[model samples]
Target: MALDFQRPDPSSPAAVASAQFTVSRRGYREEEVRDFLRQVSVELARLLERERFLESELKALQARGPVDVAAIDEAAVTELLGAEAARVLTSAREAAQAMRDRAAESAEQIVRDASREATRLLEESTLEASRRRSDVSGEAEQELELAKQQGREMIAEVRAYRERVLTDLARRTEEARRDLERLVHERERLLGAFERARHAATDVVGDLNEFDQSLRGTGVTPPLVPPDAPPPPRASRSSDTPIFDANEYAHELGAAHREERTHEVSANDVVAAEVDPTDLGQVDVSVVSGSPATQTPSTDETSPVEPSLVEHTPVESSQIQESSLASEGSQNTEVLPTSDTPEHIAEVVNIFDRQRKREAPRATPIHDAPEHPVFERVEAQPEHEVVAPVTNRVDEIFARLRTSNTERVAKETIKDLVEPEKPAVHESVFRLRDEVVTPAVESMTRALKRQLSDDENAALTHTRAKRTSLTLAAMFSPVEEHTQRYVESIHETITSVAVDAARSLSDSRRADLRSTVARGEVMEAISDMLSSDLLRPLHERIASAIDAASGDRDALATALRSLFQEWKSQRLSIVIADIAHFTYARGLFLGCDGATSVCWVVDPNGPACADAEDNALAGATTPGEHFPTGHQHPLAHAGCRCLVVPLDK
Candidate 1:
């Protein structure tokens, strides 16, 4: 921008003072310097004018005597020159004194005007600061509250997502268990069906075989045997046993007689081959079927038998089962009378081999025996009820809680928040809080304190508390158990702090301070701080922490806890210090009788920079704690060193 240096009032003091100048690395502003030089030249011109007036007066007075050529008398002219010299000297002294008086009067008026202007500006500044602080504080509080709400909501959402996932997994697990049970049931049912079908087939095959035997006239069917027929022959030894005579029971006498003749021829061939051929016709066969001494069925008569309904005692049934099991388990075959054995030598031959003499397996009638008497005993009992397969009811139940795509997407986002990058974001927010947020809040607060009057501590403390709250809201992330009760705790802590800071002041002043703290500033700094330092940064950090997490749930939970607790302790302590200082400063400003000596409030456990001035200064309360107004604030520096809280003893 260009400025006209030759303007009418360019060299005026106001112009000189208000002039804008180009700042340089190594030199003063050229325009301001030039304007100032013009002012100096103007002042020099006035001084020259005054000097010329005094000199012209002196010359006029010297010329005013009008002495003709060196005066009429030497003594008289000398006396006249002396008087004139005295008069000029008197006039100059009087005029100089009058000028001094007038200059002093002008200076006094200027001082009074400047003082009034300064007071007006200060008051106006205080009111403006109070108003700005009030607005900023309120806005900051609402925003902080909103951010906290969001943090809490986000926490709830993520947790609910995890729960849903777990519930889905559990449902699937239960469904799988039910399916397994159904499978096992089906297997058992299949085995049961197979056993039933096999048992039925075995019974059918046995009936067929018996019918075939009866047709061939080899099996004795008792139901077909005549009731009037002579009783069948019985084998005698140890226990009397009846054996069936097929020839006696046969209705076709001719076929029976022919079968007997054929058996006799075959029996003779076997006897002749075993003994001498000439002696075969004279050989007599024993009729007992199972006896070692017995031969093949006698040609003279069919083998003896009992009725078809022959009932055995319990002992006989047990014996039959034991014999069947033993015979079935053994690999050796029992030889039946094959029509070739000599009857005369049968007894002597069997006596020679002990195994042949052993009791043989009984030839039980197929008509009397039950099918599969050994294992499939269910034939006599009821059959198993068919088990129904598992229904789809369980699957439907499992699917009941299934989420829709939109809900699932939300869930995925929540679950994905635990990715590794989340914690890094958290760490960044925390870093920003520690580095940028805390210092900015404190710096702005200190600057506000400088601008505000002593009366507006309520506003001062309110603003401080609000700023603290906003910072906390930015830093809080609720992951586990409210993460040190983030939202709930901040309001109380900050409120108590604000109250405590203003409590020591008078009721009216307290109210005014609160209102003022809520209102005041040089506004640009306050507005800029709220927008840049508090609002934008707080939400960004809140977004960073809430929208993300640590590695996983547990780690994320830890991150949340660390963030909250860190903010709680560090910022709270600083806030308390700020309030304490503000309270003391206000008391001092109010000239409270209770505003006593001050004490250095710093970490006594660590090396303190505050003690550098005086070892006593770090801890000492001025005067004594015994005094009522023994407290004051001694904020010595901006860096983290010491804040002096006035002791209100």
Candidate 2:
């Protein structure tokens, strides 16, 4: 298949001619041919030498040329040709034989030349074939070397490709494994959170119990404490007890002691005073008289006498003693003591009569005395007569009572002015988009359900009501078809909203803890929260709708079931939150430019904004079209809020 570049050596005509001459002429000798001829000549020369030797042998018995040369024998040849027509015949024959030998030699020379040319051609052809073979072998070796290099390159390429494939496969496998691990870890985290939430409910119960116990221990008697314990003690007593005792006993005792002790102690005290001017003494007087204190005293005891006269002389003392004895005898005659010994007192003439008689005689003298004395006389009034000034106290008390009543009236008037009057708390039905529509839908549903089962012309009544209600639709729209379309639109909108909410919640949740939140507790808490305005709207509307239904209890139960069903389908996201960050981030949708703008907030550490921004974002419905219509998130209200923040590290 490969071409050989060797042609017939590009032979010229002259060379061809030369080669032909060398073959045909047999004596041509131009360089290469000469050398070739020389070799032929040497061969011829050996043939000649052998011919000579053979001729010599022929001379002895004669051969024509050499036997070793394989030449014709001349003599044998002459005899065979005809021994000379005796000489002439022999010469003719010999001539014929010589011609034959010469012709044979020439033929032999031509044959030798032809053989040499053939040999030369063969040698050149052999050389050309050898060179062509060498060239072909070299080419084959080079081709083999190139093939080996190509093979190595192919192997290297295969290895690189294998490595790349392995690297890609490893990357993909690692990515898949990481994704799986992340999912598993997320599920675990959800389970942990769910368990904690369940525990929180129980923890709340425990907290309530602990709080109750703490309150019970704080001074309020616990149920465990006994009831018959002693009462706590107190501090002051009545002041009148001591004052009344002193008034009852001291006055009587002091008065009785005054008369008995006056004479003896006064006399001794006077003697003591005279002997020692600085002496201060109290005289004790005992009252022995039997007469009552209310009885009149004798005139003799009332008369004033000079104490200096009694202390001056015995005669004066004797006169004073006589006067005192007579007066005492008269006093004893009027008021006797229970102890009637002479040591106590003695009977005497009527000194009281004598003093009375003397007082009548000194009446003019007494009347002649000075109008004003050195000492002022103090007259004590009776206790009964002293109370006369307080006679109008009852009237004053009545006046005070009237004044207090007027003041109380004035206080009430002032209170009325100061304190705002509270409007009477009454149940009112507030009509709002959710409020009115929610109840109406509930009512319609209940009515429809009732009509579906009842046979009291219920369906006919409902149809009539429906028609009448539709008639009222004229207030908003004139066309009945338009009203129907609107209603259908509302239904579709609400339904779509509900379905989306359900799907979002269901897809996000990784766990549930329903068993931990008992129905009783949930209901109790919900009931309490219903009092707040945040929940009041929904709670009141629901309650009212239920109450107004044809089959109230059943309707309420059905409604509750619907609500719960919706919640369950959404994984209780209305109450339970998952993917809380995404849900909270939805608020950012508010105030967004619907025309062209989109927000690009940082979720670097998950979606947690500051409290102020978050608050500003709460319940800001993203226009009518953007609001999540039937969502039941517990934090959907104006005040309630929460969010999630992923911890990347």
Candidate 3:
């Protein structure tokens, strides 16, 4: 509602309505306050209508006529006025109480409405705040999950990178170690070769000296002897001394030198210088070369280049070479007459002579005999016959000239084509093994190494693709393809060894064996044997090895490496042995063949156990009449080194 009041500036909200009050004893006339009274009457009427329920009883009593206060009545009027005043007083008190009750009800209702509005606003704000908080929390959780995922990926990447670095470092380190070992091994080999050459030269010097001394005693003009060469360096002894042990070579040939020391004679006394030549098988041929040196001109090629058992101290070939080279440019070179010698032997002798002629001269040829092959020219045959008789004589002279190396086989005990190993592999077996098994095993190992790398990378990268993998079942599963390749390589090596062994027999004998059994049948049996004895065991061994490695990748690789090496080395040996034994036993199967019967020879010197040796010996001979089965094969087991020897009737 709008209201206006009289003021000095009525439009301003700060302006106050003002009125002057004149205090007097008399009351103000009604006419003077009529406007204020009329305003009051209208407000009073509106207020009564608003509180009509509270004023119903007052309205009912208002039906009585009005009594004016100015109309004075004496005693009668005084009593009547008293009763009316009492009734009006009662009505006014009742109306005032009802109005207070209504006001209280209105105030309570306002408070309740305000309280409800405030509660609704508070609830709405709280709900909106909760929703925003929830959204932010959800976003934060998503970001945290994303960061965790990124961190895991980064860790995997870093770990993979670390693996690569370590693997490279390990490979380089291994290569360097192998290189160092190779260099050290080469150094040792060179040192040994140097020592052996020095010893040989020392021996040559001593021999030349002894030859000159013998020539002087025999009344031939002795050549000037060479100065003694420096002693060969020796291996350090337990006492750390550089001196060598007693010369075993010199000791063995002490008999030849004993005669020289025992008999001293004048140069003119040929009879006294003469010694029995029977004990000197190594002596007879030496002076014959010098005999022709005294006289030249034997042009007869068939003149039995007169080999004699001339007992004299022999000269070293090195000295012969030295003397030869010194006079090579001065003399007409000999075209050597061909002799009936082995082709390989002739080739070797030719090479030796050519080498001697071309090599640096070690000693002067001032006393070289004209009979020396280099000085005397011989007419050579125009064909395959290459080495001449003079070359043969020179070869024989050189053959006995140095320390006899016959000690290597002088005793029957050391006579073997090749020594048998714990698991015997014939030396000839290597002819095919190098071509087949070794390369296969190497490739297999390389494949395994690659597999290890792949599996390792897979493990690093796929850690959480499904559930975390904790075991090795997924890593090193055995590959059948690798095993098959392994089997084929072994088959190739063994088959080749067996075929070569059979081919070694005479053609008729091979036919006899083939007649006794079809070739394919024999091979099939052998194949079955290999499958059972070799391949099955190989697979089992690999499985056992993998199982033994547990879950460790390095351990698995190490086990595989060792197993592959064994397959290449020891297992190959066993396979070759069994195949060889089986091949020879084939001929022995039928008595008509070259082999009459077969027996197992357990090397007394081998590593075979006593029980095994005895068992082998007990069943050594398998008669041709009673053909042997696979069970009777000479190879008892993987490590058995027994030999199958065929006997003729």
Indicate the TM-score of model 1. Answer: 0.24
TM-score, model 2 to reference? 0.19
Residue pairs in collision within model 3: 284-309, 284-310, 337-388
**CA lDDT, every prediction?**
0.42, 0.36, 0.45
Candidate 3 Cα RMSD (Å): 35.2
lDDT of 3: 0.45
| Best first by TM-score, ranked | 1, 3, 2
Better of 2 and 3 by TM-score: 3
| Residue 648, model 1: Cα distance from true site in angstroms | 81
- Cα lDDT of model 3 by residue, 1-649, tens digit: 2233431221221221232223333333324234433443454455456457435644664567555657755554436446554454445445445434543554565567667778988988875665445435534655676699999999999999999999999999999998787667656655664465445444443443444444333323222222232334655434222323324334433443344435633432564255453334322123322332223323432232222222234456576556646555435543332233111100001211334444553532233333323111122222345765555777787788553666545544556556433333244433432344344444434443443334333433333235644343453344444344444544543444344444544454545434445543555555666566655676677567657766555555445445544554455555545554554444323322456555545544446665455444444354533213334444455445444544431
The best candidate by TM-score is 1
Q: Candidate 2 — which residues are off by over 4 angstroms?
A: 1-88, 197-649
Task: After the best TM-score superposition of candidate 1, give how far the Cα of residue 78 lies from its true spot, in angstroms.
Answer: 9.2
